[model samples]
Target chain A: MKNDILTVMWKERKGLFRIRGRRAQALLGMFSPVLLAIFFPLQEGVEWVQSPLSLLLAFVAPLILVGMSIPDSFAGERERHTLPTLLASRLSDRAILFGKMITSVAFGWGVTLVLLAIGLVTVNIAHWDGHILFYKPSILLADLAFSFLVAMLTAGAGVLFSLRAATAQEAQQTLMAVLLIPPMILQFGLFAIMGSDSGKARLQEVLGALSFEQIILVIVAVLLVLDVVLLMAAMSRFKRARLILD
Target chain B: MPSGIIFGFLGPNGAGKTTTINLLLGLLEPTSGRAEVLGLDTRTQPDEVRTRTGALLEHSGVYEQLSAEDNLEFYGRIWRMPATERQARIKELLSHMGVWERRKERVGTWSKGMKQKLALARAMLHRPPLVFLDEPTAGLDVMAAAAVRDDLEALAGREGVTVFLTTHNMAEAERLCSQVAVIREGKLVAIGDPDDLRARSGGPRLEIVGRGFDENALGLLRARPEITAAEVHGDHLVIDLRQETDTAPLVSLMVSAGVQVEEVRRGKASLEEVFLTLMEEER
Candidate 1:
């Protein structure tokens, strides 16, 4: 099973790369860093990585961005109606499904890494008293790998939904709901909740109390569990998938 | 009779043909039955089926950016055919499908006919023992459809490849099919040799084409009680003879009637006719 999945993925390596267009590449590159820049806007006149939100965004941005690739991965094939051809091949459903999932997650990581590179370049170029902004390069890289795990979670969820939805639009919408809700809550709702709270000092204390290492481990744990759970769901629920209308 | 028997699936639009094809390929699970290919149950060994057989669905596609040769090679690799074998197999398929000249061109730019032939080449690239095709020539022009038909028939006869063909073209089915299975909605309404199904469905139906016969000659032929039913098919009249009836009486009557009998054929009804009969039976 492992060999079959890997073989199919390798065979499709060229075509899959071609399908990941410049738009997707650009989106992936910009998403992580831009989120970081937003949380710690460069124009805000703060050091690149000092802003907790920006630092957190950079760590979590890849996780969120990875999910975006999932909807397209499975939904794209469903939209093109090519699922049957693959299903009819000698490879089993689980193998083909997992192969697609792995490929999608790989792309998610690939794009996130590209963004990471871009972020590192921009941060290094920033004039920080002739100093690098983020102190934990190793940590960020580790977080990027964690983001890859989170991407597997999102990809698995997207594929499960994509299998049944009659049209790509529905599959995308289904995946979008799952992908967008959690990270979006973190992205937009965090500030909202913080602003509405009158305990400004308490929030500051909490922000300052955050140990970057703790956040890294927490995210990693969550990402690992999510990846395993969602992957299991996607593989198991595949049998129940019926082609449904938008 | 062999390990894998290629059954031609015939039906009209919305006749559950694609549904059946999907069931066979393990794409959609049977509503309440079983699908096994090569001793590997779809429910148990889907990957096994996928690796063993190659399929070209009704609306299969390839990345627009890649050349046809690349598509073949890519799928070949997925089937785990070694690089050297894949190269030789792809070359042979491209040459045989008559797309060798344009193999370098991106599939997105190919004509409908070119793409159909390329799809066939891709399906056969791995040299899978079993193949499932859904309306393989649904959108191809006459020449291209004919070419694909030839490829499929030759694949079955020469290569001994099992081709589970799915199509709505009655004439094409009759031309190439060794055995046929007709489905309606979701039920297997008929299954057997094309000739047998046609004969049983229409009950020994026959068609004659020539000058008209007078009632006296018809009466003489009918006196034997061999003729059961007859109908007009275009310019000629179709006659259905009773079981165990000989054709000598009809020929004698036609000759005596001074009618120029240009053709005397015993046609076990056509696929279309059989399907229509099945539909009527269902109704």
Candidate 2:
């Protein structure tokens, strides 16, 4: 029964994504994944880029894609007034939420999946100069699992934010501000605070010393639980009245 | 047998017409009143009702990007209509609504009338007995509105499907609705056949046209217990007389009051007048 709803949701969202054609949503989505791949990927091997480019490959791209895209998909629905229509349908609010959440996370993860493919091709090409990082599809697959969960978190948060904004732009803006802040902070070397580098390391250097894989797992797990809880919360707040007015 | 009732609901603006329709379709919560569709309470049996009902609430809700047939197919899946049935029904509905030629065309590319017609087709696609239409002709031109009215009338009269329709167009209501409930300010003012409501609010009307008509005199007639309505049309006063009241008495009252009376014509009450009078009472 749950899978039934999820399947329908996947179909519906696939339609939504297919609304304008995958030529754009899927392509434009690649933009962020590629940027993150180029910049966020572990450097060749500076004692910091751990677990072969393949493991880090599985983790970071999915996480970033989920964090960046899922919420925005919700904003798209809120903008299109499709949410209100969906709410009025026969499906229970939970089913609707679950379906929509699935779409968001799936799309987010989907984009990451595409990016991973592109990155894999590019990573192999880049490593042609005698630097062969560990090559394991299972490591990449595990990262995908974590990415899906994080995508749920972003999607739930986006939907919750959508309830507060009148239009898609407002929802995206509000969520974007919230979502962008953490990454900006992290980019500013704030992540260095968690590093265990012992000597001659400033704030960023120390944060950079911790293994990226451990950080990814802890963050993915925490975000996964929060995402599930927030989705339930979003489902509860997902009433017809709020949808029409919101 | 049709699983859904093409229930007919009619209410004027501000009468919670939109709100009521929304509630019926599970688009909104009823502040007090509860609605049941297909033997299911809208609140608890939303899924059952939705699956059974095909609604065109307000206007076109097409995804706009998809073609007309695509929209119908999408909604068909949502209603759990069979995959094999989806395409055939979409074609049938689009043809019935006279949009089959444009089935492959995007909804966003269609005109307002076309969009509305397509929306109606989509609503009727699932063969749901219960269809809720909230001013489906709202944005159409006169000819389109008439076409829609004809379609609704045919659906109800020929198909025997109960259609719940809400429209401010009294003529449309009179033509399309077997029974209408006039609502104002969230309260139901009157409920019955249009003819019955008109007949019940009856008075033999004396249509008098004359020069220098005393406007205040008509007001006096309205004040009288016997006069149900006194409508001033340019130089004429179309008066509705009470059952117990005779036209002779009105002539006498005018004579006694020293007023000149012109040609008097007795006429039946119109639904428009009856509803206007009902709304007046509500105000």
Candidate 3:
């Protein structure tokens, strides 16, 4: 099983950038994140590394990157008529699922790490003082955990959509829409709560009671649970019989 | 059904040829009955069956963006062929298919025939004991189809693998398959050797190339108890026989009646004719 998953990863690695017209799209998709990595550090100077500003790049980069990849890895195979042959091979369903999920997560999380490094470099070069500035240990840890979890979240959700989608574009569009819902709801909930003085007071009271570390830990724990739930859902749906029919 | 012969599974569009192949591969479960491949129950041991078999499904199933070598290389890895052995086998198969020179080019750039050939090479890369090909030559031009057919025949012969081939091309079935089965609406209608099916579908036939075929000669030939139907198509007289019988007496009768008989050919029905006859009978 391990060998089979590795074999699948081997193929996925080759196909990641080599697919027709995908290179251009991938480069174009990287443009925004690249810009953020450079522009934010230059604008914010030392705050980019010491504060939570870099976390934005960490969260959004993996979501977009993994979003672009998981659909293509899953639905693109079906759209191009290769999934049947792959499923017909000696590969078990779990190997295929984990192989694709791992590849997408690695690509997304790996690229986010690079972008974060680029931001750090941009900040140091822009604000060259007596010493080089780097991301604070806490910020760096949060960025890593958040980016990795977001990558997993996107991959898990993307697989579910890809399994039912007829085309890669459809899966991608649907995944993006679904990913937007949580933040949209959070924004609305925050707005509504802050709109009322009493509600805002209560929120600040609750927040004031907890340390930043506790809050970060709580969010991480929630994301970890969601990631596991989505992964389990993807595994349950990734049956060979179901995929063949799809 | 045997160990090392191409068994042709004949069916029309949507006649469940692909479905049956999926079942045998364990990609789809049998709602009722069960199947076994290489003595492994498809229901209980499908992975084992798939490990021992290869398949070229309805589609070519090749990655168009990847080079041909990469395509075969990926499957070679899937089967866990060692690096050296996989490379050598890829070279051997691609060389045999006469596409080794073009192995570095993306398959999407190749013509349909070439892509189909590459897909074939991928299927045979593992040298499995059995391979299932679903309409392997389905959408190719005449020359391209023949090229694929030749490759299939040579590879199957060289590998000594049992090929479970599904095709509507009866001529292809006749040439490549030692035994054939016809299915319609998910049920087996007929199963036998090509010759046996041909003979069973229609009786012996006689065609006489002559310039003096007339209604009078046709009438006399049709009156014989052994002849089922006789018709003159231009200068040729075609006689459908009730059974295999001596044609000398009939030729002598035609000559005595002043009908010029230039050449007489005795033959059984072709596989295509047999397939059509079976379909018509089922209807």
Candidate 4:
């Protein structure tokens, strides 16, 4: 199983790096995170490492990266006429699924970590506080967990969308829309809560009641569950015969 | 099911040739029946069957974005060939196909013929006991098709691999396949050695090329007990004779009818003729 998965990964990685005519799109994908990593660290000074809000960058970074990559990996294989041959190989269905998912998630999560590290160094150098400034351990852990979970979420949803979409562009569009729903709902929920004086007060009271660690923990748990559900959904949708027919 | 021969699966488009190949490779499950490959039940031991066989599917199945060497390297690893041996084998196969110098170039940049050759090399790289090739020379120009046919002939002969080839090219099937199976609409029509099929479809045929043939002459020829069927084919009169009987009587009859016979040649029907007869019989 390990060897099979690795073989799929090797192919996935080769395809990812060897993409043609999409370099500009790839750089554009990295542009936002890179700009934020540099500009935010420079503008926010040492506050960049001290605030829990920095977790937003971590989450969105991977969401964008993995969202872009997972669809291309899955639907792109079908569109480029390579999926049937790969399915005909000795590799099991799970091996192909997990291999591609891991490659995309790792790429997104790995690059986010790099950007985070670069952001930290940039902040330290610009502020020159005569001490090495770093994100608090709690915030760092939250960022890692959040970023990894979002990457998995995007990848899982991407797989599901790619399975039905006739083209990579269609899958990417559908997956991006799916990924945006939760945040959009959250924004509406927040607006509803803030619209009422008593609701706002109660929300603040509850927030004040719970420790920051507890909030971060709750968020991580929710994301973890979501990631698992989406992963299972994607897995159930994948079948060698179905894919061949498709 | 014999060992070490090029077995041709002949079928027309939409005749389920690719589906059959997929079934044997264990990539597709039969709706009712089951299949076995290399002694492994395809349904139960699909992975084993796939690991032991190779396929150049309908589309060549080559990664166009990668170099020829990379494509072979990837599949070699899939077959778990060792590093040294894999490299040596890749070099050997590419060199054998006369595409060694272009191995470093991406397959997308190569001509369709070269890509087909590379794909064939990849299929033979692991030297599996069985290989499936679907229309390997389907769309190539005459020269390119001949080149690919030569390569296929050489590799099939040299490696002693069992080739399950699918094609609509009757001439190719006649030349390369020792045994052939004809399928139409998901059903097997005939399966046997090419010669047997040609013989079974009809007995010896006689072709007389001359312009002095008319409907009266054809009617007279068809009336003979030795000739089963007679028709004007292009500018010639073709007769399907029964039981290797002499054509002298038919020729004498034609002469008596004031018809001229420019040439007389007697031989078995070609595979194309056999295939057409099978399809006609099926319909």
Best by TM-score: 3
Model 3 clash number:
0
* Per-residue lDDT of candidate 4, residues A1-246 (tens digit): 888778878887887846675567778888898988899899999789988767878988998898878887767878877777677776778888999999999999999999999999999999996899989999899999999998998899899998878888899889888778888999999999999999999999999999989999999899899899999998899977788788
The TM-score measured for candidate 4 stands at 0.97
Q: Pick the candidate with the highest lDDT.
A: 3
lDDT of candidate 1 over B1-283, digit per residue (tens): 2345567888768988877666666666666878777777976665567677778877756645578888787678667788899888888888877788888887878787777777777787777788888898897889888887887777667677888888878888888777888877777788888888877877675566787666665566557677777555565767777774677667767787776788887756678888888888887
For every prediction, compared with the true complex, DockQ reads 0.40, 0.36, 0.88, 0.67
Whole-model lDDT values for every prediction:
0.69, 0.66, 0.92, 0.88
List candidate 1 segments past 4 Å from native: A11-13, A16-46, A49-68, A123-134, A137-146, A167-170, A183-210, A240-246, B1-6, B31-46, B61-65, B185-190, B196-221, B232-234, B243-271, B274-283
Q: Tens digit of lDDT per residue, candidate 1, span A1-246?
A: 898788656644555545536356646656555656443434443344443433454445554554444555556666665555555566656777777778767866676666555555666665456765663555665546566776677777888787766665577677767666787888676677677656556767776787766666777788788878888887777652253111
lDDT tens digits by residue: candidate 4, B241-271: 8878877888888888888768888889999
Select the stronger candidate by DockQ from 2 and 3: 3
Q: Lowest-scoring 10 consecutive residues by lDDT in candidate 1 chain A?
A: A237-246
Residue-wise lDDT of candidate 2 within B12-111, one digit each (tens)?
A: 6677888877777766677776888767898777677777776776646666767777777767776767778887887777777777887888777778
Worst 10 residues of 1 chain B by lDDT: B1-10
Error at A152, model 2, angstroms: 2.3
Comparing 1 and 4 by DockQ, which wins?
Answer: 4
Instruction: Please give the lDDT score for candidate 1.
Output: 0.69
Higher-lDDT candidate among 3 and 4?
Answer: 3
TM-score of 2: 0.80
The window of 10 residues in a row where model 4 chain B has the poorest summed lDDT is B242-251
Least accurate 10 contiguous residues by lDDT in model 2 chain B: B1-10
